[model samples]
Target: MTSVSIPRRMKGVQIKNFGDAEVLQYKTDLPVGVPGHGEVLVKNEFIGINYVDVYWRRGMMGIPPNGIIGREAEGTVVSTGAGDVNSLKVGDRVVWLAMGGYAEYTIVPASLAYPVPADIKPGVAAAALLQGLFAMSLSHKIVQVKEGNWALVHAAAGGVGLWLCQLLKALGAKTIGTASTAEKMKLAVENGADYVINYEEEKDLVKTIEEVTGGYGVDVVYDGIGKDQTQNNVNVVAKHGTIVTYGAASGFPAPISHATLTAKNIRFVGPAESALMRNIGGGFEKWCAKLFDTIANDKINVVIHDTYSLSEIVRAHKDLEARKTTGKVLAKP
Candidate 1:
């Protein structure tokens, strides 16, 4: 431990009751928690706002009531509890993914805490972990992206959508991104998308994709936006192509059909976050090392759309649900 002044009380957003983002109650008088053995208390510099936070707050996920709602943050370790926690020490700049991140100070298991590169900005570091890994897994692990493959990324200006576009480009693949607004379409193009589809102005999404590919169709479709788009995704993919329905932002997708998958030879699977965590958790240190290298080399860009104070979390969530943000939304306390 160093000579940093530790606070006994902190501010944070807690789920008063699960429903909408309105349920998030920002409390200034919450007690700052002490780190247990092998845990480190982080003075959060920036907390990443993700849709999963919405799921937790909406009763769609299993998080308990009064749970502080967030999964990732970048901060400096202000104190450490007694245990062997590898190379971590007080004052080290690190990124950590753990719940209770919607706060001024968060306690994270030491092993899950990763050191941030000195050159990486705090916002970028805060943006990198879960969303970045999800993008990486889709490219490198879930489906090995090959050179010259054609891909479709829905919600292209969204956090993971931009990452998917950039990483696909790095792998020598082409991406056609679908976005609702012209601003979002331009953002997708800026982030390495080969083509941008303004789905708002377009009527048939499947037709647009087919026309872009000269009727050849895309090799992969990343459908993070669900609802009716799920069925339309099945129609748009090429023969032997793959579809990763990683999320359902619009709502839960229509039930998939085995007959359709068998008929098209399309491999339809969802991004298994928990399974990925189990398999890659042990190798995360190495993955993060490579991620930093890629970032340093400017292989991809990490965009910070907006910043909000912890007290304005309700506003942040409102803006997020309204689709007014692009790339990553960050909050600092």
Candidate 2:
């Protein structure tokens, strides 16, 4: 490793007992962890704030007490432990998908870290990697989206939602996106949603989608809003279409009987993170490469809702939970 000064301690946020944002105790004296074998230590420049972070903080994701939280970050590889790091070297700009990113530095498994392209901004890479890869998986792996397919994307103005809209459009699929507010609906449309529905104003979601699809329901329904929208997904998806319940922004959806899926001959996908992670070792590297190419070629737009200081993480959580953010939320440490 090239010579570079690394601090003994770093600033970070940890939860003593998960409950709310208040439990996130930020401190300047947290120990900077050393990279073990097959690990590389990153000096994070930008950290992505995801709803999954909220789940972890709220005790909904089964995190142990007194642990740091955060899943993804972009930074420079400062040092490497004793193992092959997949060609990673000191000073390489990289983005990693790993836990404990709400800190000045993070120890990431070398396999989970991908080098960032020179033209892509670190913050943009941070904002795009995890969500963009997930959206790509949904588009290409979860359901083979064909041209002319009609897709319904819930929370279409959000980080992953915006990505879904653009990816679907790129695949020649028409999209109907739902948002809670008029502004968000407009953003979704601007991001390539063929039709935008303000769910807050639309009384009958099923009827609205049916009318939009002209009696034939959407070819696929991406329901990230979870509990509040899962049932509506079944009503809006076309026969043999897929319904992907990918997140729990509104809380996990209630259990649905297999008969419910059999009734319509529809496919239901509730992707487990563990199963998703099965691909992370190699699949993510490929996805990130493709995702960045799309972004660089102007096929996808990365929208940042707001960037907050690491100290303002509480406010960040509050705003995200309140649905005040329209796109990706990021933090600088």
Candidate 3:
């Protein structure tokens, strides 16, 4: 590792009291701690904004108050602690998902840091890590979408949805996506969706999607929008098909009846990204390598809805919660 300048203090967003975006506090006096053994210090250049970050800000998730709040970020490594951990070196450009990413600097375990390719911008790197991995696992592993197969993606303009749609296209599968508005539907189409349904204006969404698929239901349905979409997804899914419901954006799906599944021969599955990564067989390194190649080669592109400076962190959360943004939002410090 080469020598680098050190700093003693930096700015970070502190969660003093969790309630909403208003509760996020920006502080310039946060201490920049030295990296501990097996960890490296990253000067965060871009912090990825995700709904999970909203969960933390809304107090929906249990996390300590007065701590930095962010999950995914891309940055330059400035230093490393003792021990040869994960073959990390100073000056390496990297992506990481450690906590405290909404800061000038984040200290992450070397095991958690992955070097980014030269051509991948910090915005793309930050957006691709969490959502990209989820899309890869859901499209390629969980669903095993083959050529000519069909999949339905709800919230197709969403962070994960857009990426998933692109990956499905790369695999030669078609996507029938449902978006809330005409603009969003257009965005979905631009992101590789073969068919788009304006769910907000359309009645009988399931019937519409079925009509698109020529009366045969889709092979798989990615339901990020829950609640009322449950029955729609079930009715629109083909026999022996799978439903991958990963999020409850509108709210959890209403309790399901087992008879419904049995009658349609449907299989409902939802796996956490952490657990699914373990069962991916090839490990995170290989999965990431393939995913990065896809993005670099233009097989999949990160659709950034908006970008904010570190000072506008609160507005970032507000934009996401109000559904005013599509795809991914990024925060640059």
TM-scores, all candidates, are: 0.96, 0.97, 0.95
lDDT per residue for candidate 2 within 120-181, as digits (tens), equals: 97599999987888888889888889999999999999999999999999999999999999
- How accurate locally is residue 263 in candidate 3, as Cα lDDT from 0 to 100? 92
lDDT of each: 0.86, 0.89, 0.85
Ranking, TM-score, top scorer first: 2, 1, 3
Per-residue error at 178 for model 1, in Å? 0.3
For model 2, what is the alpha-carbon lDDT of residue 259? Answer: 95
TM-score (C-alpha) between model 3 and the true structure:
0.95
Please provide, for model 3 over 1-333, each residue's C-alpha lDDT reduced to its tens digit, 9 standing for 90 to 100: 489887898988998777878888888889988889899999998898888787777676678434787887998899898886688888999998667888999988887788999988657999888889988889878889999988999989989989988888889998998888888899999989999988888978877877888989899999877785888888889999999887777877877679988998988987667566556768777877887898889878799988899899989988888878899999998
Global fold similarity of model 2 (TM-score): 0.97
Number of the top lDDT candidate: 2
The order by descending lDDT is: 2, 1, 3
Assess candidate 1 and give its lDDT: 0.86
Worst 10 residues of 2 by lDDT: 273-282
